[model samples]
Target: MSVRVLLVDDNPVVRIGLRSLLELDDRMDVCGEASSGQEAVAVASRERPDVVLLDVRMPGSGGLDVLPALTQLSRVLMLTYSDEPAVVSEALRGGATGYLVHGAFQSDELAMAIIDTAEGRPRLSPAAASVLLQGFHGGGTAVAEAPATHDRAEPTVVPEVVKQHALSRREVEICRLLVAGMSNGDIARRLFIEEKTVKNHLNRIFAKLGAANRAEAIATCLGTRRGA
Candidate 1:
């Protein structure tokens, strides 16, 4: 079955371009389009799409304002121009399944992101990943000042905040790998555990950390949240 997607952006040209790009993929079906946050919610509630491609800045209620509602309706992947660490962190905290900065991904990558998000996997573009890693490293800067690659070196020791969360040793190991940008499959292979086992650990980790998603969990662990 084709993955139903809702395009939410204030720009008509952007929506049309995205629709045209996504239509090239046989696995995607553009279910609806909305030019504002409120309209996006109304259309998504009606269409019940598998995934929502959301823009951060809109006229009335921006993407952040309506993010919580949109997330409850469907998996949301932020497709925006902003790559600020704070904005990325907030969007993740708001329950976005993935973050992709505009101009940082190709059409094929966008299609893959929609599919992955619908399948419950978080996708981060290189720029977004850079922001998260910079936040993880306590670097107060934008993506332009950070490295362009997601191959940053993993921390040698887990942060004390993670210990405060009382995560088990294995869970700590998983969190370390996650901060290093390893996916569940990659972490599973690296730790010699099943992917399902990794996910189970992550669930417990998130619960303990009071995190809504992996990004939030990492932010909490590293104490990288902007106003925390």
Candidate 2:
């Protein structure tokens, strides 16, 4: 199916340019446009596009302001020029499907981003991720900056599976770790199992849970809890 897209940006030129660029791909179509965060939310609610490319900074309501409201309408892909990792993290925490660098992306890259976000993954621009890594793990040492404002790619969604049956105890453990962003290697290490064995167990867990990925699996488990 063609990916229906909504363009949300204050700049008329940028919006028109983006619409023109994305239209080149036969799989993409601009179903709507909004000049502000609030308008974007309204248009999104009505259009119910497959993906939304939103600018981070806008008057009255910024990307953060309208993000949650758009959640019910469509997957949101942050297409902005902002380089702040804190902003990125907050957007993810607030339910953004993906993040991309508007200055650096090509039409094809944006198309791929739409596909990725539609599937439910968090994609960050490489440069943006590097900034985040530096801020989180590089200590006080500053990393070399990229000379140019380059385009970046981010995921729209991470594939998750559903639980079709009751989960086993071990499956619950895995689900918990997965929700916490623990990698398979980490989960295996904690469980005293080989990583390959963990993969096998996860396979069964997905099938039994009817989930496409760890997030869905975890959400299923959480739904059965007292306050989930």
Candidate 3:
């Protein structure tokens, strides 16, 4: 089936270009377009597109501002020209489904991104990956549980709930950021990844944590922290 999509950006030219580029792919369909956050929300609600290609900055609602509004509408791919970590992190925290940079990908890459976005994989600009890698490990050695020094033996078993979907190192990193209240954009900035990549990481985290939303994920991790 063709993947349905919506374009949300203030720039008519950008929207037109994206529409043309995306329409060339037989597997993708441009169902609608909205020039502002409010318009995007309204149109998305009505059309219920499978994904939204969103701009990072808009007139009244920046990428961060329109996030909550689009939560129920569709998966969002934030497109921006800036690679600033701060901006990336904010979008991620606000719950963007993916992040992309304008002019970062060619037609094929963009097509692949549309496919991946449907599968819940995040697509980021190549440079964003390097940024995220730096952010992931730069935060000092993850505080591991210390071995029992006295008579008591430390539990070696992974928690029953979380054990079902063992979190990878990347998931762990994303979890730390979520618990820290960093937006996906911010996490992307800190990690030097695109905000979209952060979203992908977060999808893994949600599965591992058995969480439906960020708040639940945070609470689950924090609950464990209290015991640790």
Best model per TM-score: 1
C-alpha root-mean-square deviation, each candidate: 14.6, 17.5, 16.6
lDDT (Cα, tens digit) per residue for candidate 3, span 50-69? 88888876666555677778
- Lowest lDDT 10-residue stretch of candidate 2: 148-157
lDDT of each: 0.79, 0.70, 0.68
RMSD of 1: 14.6
Off by over 4 Å in 1: 134-228
Candidate 3 residues lying further than 4 Å off, grouped into runs, are 134-228
Clashes of 1: 0
TM-score for candidate 3, please give it: 0.58
Candidate 1 per-residue lDDT over residues 1-228, each given as its tens digit: 999999999999999999999898899999999999999999999999999999987777778879999988999999998665556766776778889988888767888888999988888977667656654321112333433233556653346666677878888888877776665655777889876688789899889888887678778767885432
How does residue 74 of candidate 1 score in lDDT? Answer: 96
Quote each prediction's TM-score.
Answer: 0.59, 0.56, 0.58
Compute the lDDT of residue 135 as modeled in candidate 1. 46
Better of 2 and 3 by TM-score: 3
